[model samples]
Target: MDYFLQLVLNGLFVGAFYALVALGYTMVYGIIKLLNFAHGDIYMVGGFVGFTMLTAASGAMGAKGGLLLLIVVMVLAMLTTGTLGLIIERIAYRPLRGAPRLSILITAVGASFALEYGIALAYGPNPRAYPVGMGTGSFNVFGVRISTGQLVMVVIAVILMIALDTLVRRTRSGRAMRAISQDPRACLLMGVNVDSVIARTFFLGSALAGAAGVMAGAYYGKIDFLMGFIIGLKAFTAAVIGGIGNIRGAVLGAIVLGLLESFGTAWLGSQWRDVFAFGFLILFLTVRPTGLLGERVTERV
Candidate 1:
């Protein structure tokens, strides 16, 4: 029972991170119908930015600047990455908007590879340890040990998801975004700036990925150029599982994937963990390809 509780708690944390990152992929897919493969690199960039800031802070203020400086770095990185997302849309994606989907997809793949290799060149081909000010202390919940960092991460993820859900459903900008997503031509006729709306969506998604980057840096304690690849794949899987293009679906998918991975790793041994998890995904897809809450989309004749 204790072990089960521990796994559940840990799964929640992993889910939070996955959900946050998956938001980027699913949102862009919803609005643009493009995968935005470079999203993982955006996440990678955020991690590196935060890492550099932490190294500088530690050098200047030692342990004294630990918590406060970390906060500043995260905020800066998020804002930077958000802006970067806008530029990426404008530069790499917008120009190809009217092009063939295959062309745009190849371009996206190229962009992703460029970002990855660029980071490798800049940061070198090595993993850097993330500095943390927090000590490992936990609250005992029915013989389950849960740490402050894990709890904080989960809370932050939930709050951000709620905030994003509200932004999309309740706000005027969000309405414009939805209109654009449904039919960009109609949205344009209705005086909605489709390009701006798309940029904003990317900004929001990238910002969330940035936050995930910081949280990962704090908890996982390592940063590498290729770090985002595997996790990005997992997050993409989560988005698909939840219902691509649906915010709540992404969150739901993430939790299920996290729980599945956690339990599989613990019970079946680490070697078969990913295989088992993806195998379950395949089975789920066979039954319900649209995912838990996904809408049935039809093609126009």
Candidate 2:
């Protein structure tokens, strides 16, 4: 039982990362119906940005100021990645908005490649050791050992998710987003600047991905340019599992995927983790394409 409980705790921590990244996927899909494949690269960018900042500051800040420095680095990384997301949406996606879906999708793929290679060109094709970490201190509760770093990461993730939820449910911008998602033409007719709203959506979503990236780097202790690729797909799977356009569904789906991976890893081996995750994705697509919380919408032909 203790072993099972430990797995569950670990799963929740892993799920926090998925939840952050998946929110971006769902938000972009919700607003413009575009699957920004490059979104994951934005996450990679965040990690690199955080890495750069930490590397520069680590010597001066020392261990005493580690927490404060980390907070500042995360904010800067989020801002940088958010701006990058806005640029991608404006330059890559906006031009192809009226074009066929396949065209935009290809462009998204191109953008992803561009970001990945661009980072590699700048940072080299080598894995970077994170300059800072959340320390290796842990405590046990009910015989389930939990790391402080994981607890901190989960708390921050939950706060961000809650803030996003409030924004979506209560803010005017969020209302515009929902409105555009339902009927962009109608929202445009109703005097909403659909383009601006879409841009904001991309910004916010990418910002969340950025936060996840920084957190992951701090926790895992290493990062690389291509790191976002697999995680990006996993996050997309999480979005789909929860219903692509539903905010709460994305979080729920992330937790579900995380738990699945945790238990699967324990049962099988770590080497089979990706296979387990993708396999479950295939199963979900086959059984319920709309997702657990996704509703079937009948579109006009």
Candidate 3:
């Protein structure tokens, strides 16, 4: 029972990270219906950016001013990653919007490689140590040990999820996004700037992923160029498990994936962690392609 509780705690903590990365994929799919394969790489970039900002600040202010410096770094990371997302949409995706899905898919693959090598050149092909200095303490609840860092990460993920959910459910932009998702041509006819909305969607998704990258860097204490790949893959599985294009589904999927993976690791050993998670993903897709909460989508033809 104690071990079970510990696994549950660890799973929830990891799920928060998955949810953050999944948001970018779901949001982009929501508006554009294109799987931005480069999104995973965008997340990797966010970690590096946060790492640089955090390290530079740590040098200047020492651990005493960590909170203030962290806040500033967070803002910079969100802005930088958000802007990069918009640019990627415009420069990489926009031109191919009306083209075949195959063409856009290839473009996404190219963009992914470009971002990866670009970062490797700029940062060098070495793992960088993430700055430490976040909260440090642990409390036991019913024999489940929980650390302050995990607690903070879970809270931050929740805040981001709530803020995003509210914005999607309540705002005019949200309405526009939904309309475009349903019928982009109709939205354009209704005088909604479909292009701009898609751009904003990319920005929001990338910004959230960036924030998650920051949290992950803090928690894990190290980062690399390919850090987002495995997590991103899991998050996509989560999105698929819940319903790929649904925001609510992404969150639900993330929690389920996190808990399941955590339990799988505990029961089946760490070596088979990914294999188990991915096996479930394949099984789910084969059995129920629409996912747990996903609406059934049909081809136009």
Task: Give the TM-score (vs. native) of candidate 3.
Answer: 0.96
Candidate 1 displacement at residue 226 in angstroms: 0.3
For model 2, the local distance difference test gives 0.92
* Order by TM-score, highest first: 2, 3, 1
In candidate 1, which residue ranges exceed 4 Å CA deviation?
Answer: none
TM-score of each: 0.95, 0.98, 0.96
- Better candidate number, 1 or 2, judged by lDDT: 2
lDDT digits (tens) for residues 241-285 of candidate 1: 998887789889999999998999998898987797688678767
- In order, candidate lDDTs are 0.85, 0.92, 0.85
Residue-level lDDT of model 3, residues 1-301, one tens digit each, is 9998898888888888899889889888878778888888888888889888887877776654455565567668878899999999999999999999889989988888888889889998898878865567889899888987788778878998999999999999989998898999999899999999999899999998888877777778778888877877888899899899899999989989999989998888999999988998998899987888998878887
Q: Can you give the lDDT of residue 148 in candidate 1?
A: 73
- The backbone clash count of each candidate, in order, is 0, 0, 0
- Which candidate ranks first by TM-score, i.e. highest? 2
Question: Where does model 2 exceed 4 Å of error?
Answer: 62-65
Q: Which scores greater on TM-score, model 1 or model 2?
A: 2
On lDDT, who's better, 1 or 3? 3
